[model samples]
Target: MFESPNELNIARKEHKHLSFSAGIYYCLGGQAAKLEIEVAFNCLCDKFKQPRLQEEPVWRKNSNMHGMEMLMIAI
Candidate 1:
């Protein structure tokens, strides 16, 4: 709700271009999504002892998405 108009416009454009966009419905429930992600990450870290990175990740190219293609975790 506090976001600027320009930021929201950019987001709307990006969402339109993306194939997997979840739309404003997700934004309306962003708090719930953030909480779930936090809980899962915390639980995983707590349960895994001495969890370390095993390898460098190679990101996917020529794509609009910017997430890790491969994340090697040594647990």
Candidate 2:
């Protein structure tokens, strides 16, 4: 969702490490993985009163990955 190069660049720099798995060929199951995660999260959220974060997570951006590296959530 970052619209500018500066924003994207800053997010990418917040992390100390990076990895990329798009090697010889692209992942054939990427969509399946995404769908699976979404379904699981939706079910959990529906059953919870309030999803609370344990702490603010580091936002890391790198090639093919952009998400919380460590997170704890409770209802």
Candidate 3:
């Protein structure tokens, strides 16, 4: 048997909620706003069946908006 010269991390993980900075970050209507957005996304997903990406998304290549840049989808 031989050893491999590569990397394998089994602990590190990432997601949308993990993007925010630490501490009690708050806003006047932040909770409401997030609920609204999540509801909207859920509604869209319910309406669209198997909505898939047409191509590789161009997300935050170089822009102020860290959100989705170009999400080419086909319902």
Candidate 4:
């Protein structure tokens, strides 16, 4: 943000991008997605040791859709 008429904001500590956009383009599923991701990470950390990729991931052709077709993880 700029300081045209007010304050220019900056992070005082750590920073991370969540990608929860604003206005009409904002992701309506952002909260749910964040919750799911947190739960999944917790589960993985609790149940597994150091996880690693076992093979190259396969992806779909849909440009708007971002995900893996098959992910093989070795702990």
Which portions of model 2 miss their true places by more than 4 Å? Answer: 1-24, 58-69
Q: lDDT of each model, Cα atoms only?
A: 0.56, 0.58, 0.55, 0.62
* Candidate 4, RMSD to the unseen true structure: 10.0
Instruction: State the lDDT at 4 in candidate 3.
Output: 28
Which residue runs does candidate 3 get wrong by more than 4 Å? Answer: 1-18, 26-30, 63-65
How do the residues 1-75 of candidate 2 rate in per-residue lDDT, one tens digit apiece? 334433323224433232224656656776687588779878877989777676665566764666656666767
Winner by TM-score between candidate 4 and candidate 2: 4
Using TM-score, give the best candidate's number.
Answer: 4
List, residue by residue over 1-75, the lDDT tens digit for candidate 1: 334422212124332332335666336656676588679768878999876668765566645665566767789
> lDDT order of candidates, best first?
4, 2, 1, 3
Which of 2 and 3 is the better model by lDDT?
2
What is the C-alpha lDDT profile of model 4 across 1-75, one tens digit per residue? 323312222222433433576779878998898799779967876898876667766665666764567767788
Least well predicted 10-residue stretch by lDDT in candidate 3: 1-10
Model 4 ranges off by over 4 Å: 1-22
Query: How would you encode candidate 3's per-residue C-alpha lDDT over 1-75 as one tens digit per residue?
Result: 213212122133432342343457635566687689779868878999876667766656554435556768688
Count: clashes, candidate 4: 0
Show pairs that collide, candidate 2.
none
Clashing pairs in 3: none
Deviation from truth (RMSD, Å), model 3:
8.8
